[model samples]
Target: MSPYTRPSIAPQVFVDADGQVIDYGHRWSDSPPTEAYSVTVHPERYAPLHAVAAALIDHLRLTYDVEVDEGAHVVADLLVAPSWDVPRAVRVRPRDPKCAALTFVFTAFPGVIVHAGLLHDFPYPLCGCDACDTTWQREADELEEHVFAVVSGNYSESVERRDGEPAAWYQVRFANGSSGGSSSISTVAPERLEAAAVTLPDLPSGWRPWPLRHAAEA
Candidate 1:
């Protein structure tokens, strides 16, 4: 979004008596301005640095269709902290009260947005019912099994009953080279294992499952 026409504020820079740079930083306003938002640009690297800052604001406006007030300002600042790993922070104020104002802080890397904190307060419906939890758990289990099979190169599976009970338990055997045969077994239960078997896909190499320990075993 186009920023409001406000007076530009120069970032403070500190240097030693020998002309060595000590600190280069900008301080954010303690209170929100009378307008919507503000922009700060670093004095030493204003041109290219402010371009990056302006592009980020434009992205939020175009992508999210957000409105910018005519009186707000944009500040481009220097990386004063020892760590340059800070993410760009954007604060949005929507005119509608029902729509909550949001602050999005995210690291902008090539082809990825890392450590994003966008939807922490976004209004999204969430279900914690047993049925919903069970369904989600089953899907996750199936995904884990598929990854395990691909990594271990073992697709052999079977369902069997113990002590004349229903055949609701299933086991997958993996080939262990040290044993000179397939003997490593992974077990799953509760009848949903059959459904996973039916939907199993032929996996390729280089896929691995996260080491997961069952709570019952714990």
Candidate 2:
């Protein structure tokens, strides 16, 4: 499936200097004057984009406590030009009069090139604002509430085994009784179903594995 086909969701992103994403439901604004340094990955090197993006994000989080949006488009601020060359580095100067200019650099070895001094500071603190805190809490609360909802039966589920596979697939019915959503749940042994069930979300949620799908399953 194409990466852009999914429903609208918050990007797995860390806002530049604000320490918080723009907003959960809003789009990242590129209104302010900004500069972006991007590298066009040769088609042969395309497979590494995921790892490159991930490494960049990890570097930001580990070194600067900055988080990029999870959505591929949003993470690289490529919404308008979704197919724009993958951004290896991005710098934003928010239109807000109070914000400061910030830069981000992403690099991976063996093929990905590292821009010198691309990251303004090797280690920096995430933005600490009431808005940031509230955004963080909102995401956390939504997740916790959804998990409880699923475990409490606000959502119902059906299990079916694929014809050729040993795994069972799960179809979840939301609290509102909506259908059309499903996932593979074959990896959770029967013994651990209960424990796994408690972690699944029943609400409209993000990309996180709800109902506890094992990583190995992916």
Candidate 3:
């Protein structure tokens, strides 16, 4: 069958900043394929980072040809007021009435796009309030520590390819937010990245399940 003839379906996978698979999504190949199954992702569900939402949307579109709605996934800047006290300072989501889940979610890294393993490492920190920070100090520390794993300059220098062409690379963004940029690590050639690890850091995280029909908005 052609690559795009039937929608790509596979086990959902999750990974850490080190690119280690944490949990693989359940799969049922024996089950018959059907279009009736549906899952909804409320924009108001889990507040996510702006950049993360962008990356997720981009990945969905480029990887699966999905479309995100404005109502369900709000694009404008979202403010998590200091006085109000929420985890994130800002959030973004689809503003659409509802977000439908796909029949299956890809949990592994996309062979095409550059996966930001930094989600587990250099993630944008979220703190609801000063009191919460003091109360949940331990939890915050544990979470922040995970992000640190992918921040070093060693991993950022690596590069990867897409569809037989050089596509994306990695780099460390400094705390100062003034220095650093992406670098090429694809010296091994495209075929290598498609089959095995290009960077020495660790294996890239696997993809997870997402809405199949709504994929066009991505």
For residues 56-123, write the lDDT of model 2, one tens digit per residue.
33433333322233323332321112222444555433232122223333333212221111111221
Per-prediction backbone clash count? 11, 14, 40
Taken over the whole model, the C-alpha lDDT of each candidate is 0.28, 0.31, 0.28
Instruction: Give candidate 3 misplaced runs (Cα > 4 Å).
Output: 1-48, 71-127, 134-208, 211-218
Please give the TM-score that candidate 1 achieves against the real structure: 0.20
Residue 182 lDDT, candidate 2, scale 0-100: 36
Summarize candidate 1's per-residue lDDT along 36-150 as a digit string, tens digits.
1332222132222233334444544443423443211211111111122333445543333222233322222201011111111110101212222212223223333322342
Segments of candidate 2 deviating more than 4 angstroms: 1-24, 29-138, 171-173, 179-186, 189-218
Tens-place lDDT per residue, model 3, 75-118, is 11221112222222212121221221111111111001112332
Model 2 Cα RMSD, Å? Answer: 19.9
TM-score of every prediction relative to native: 0.20, 0.24, 0.20
Choose the strongest candidate by TM-score.
2
How large is the C-alpha RMSD of every model relative to the true structure?
23.4, 19.9, 21.1
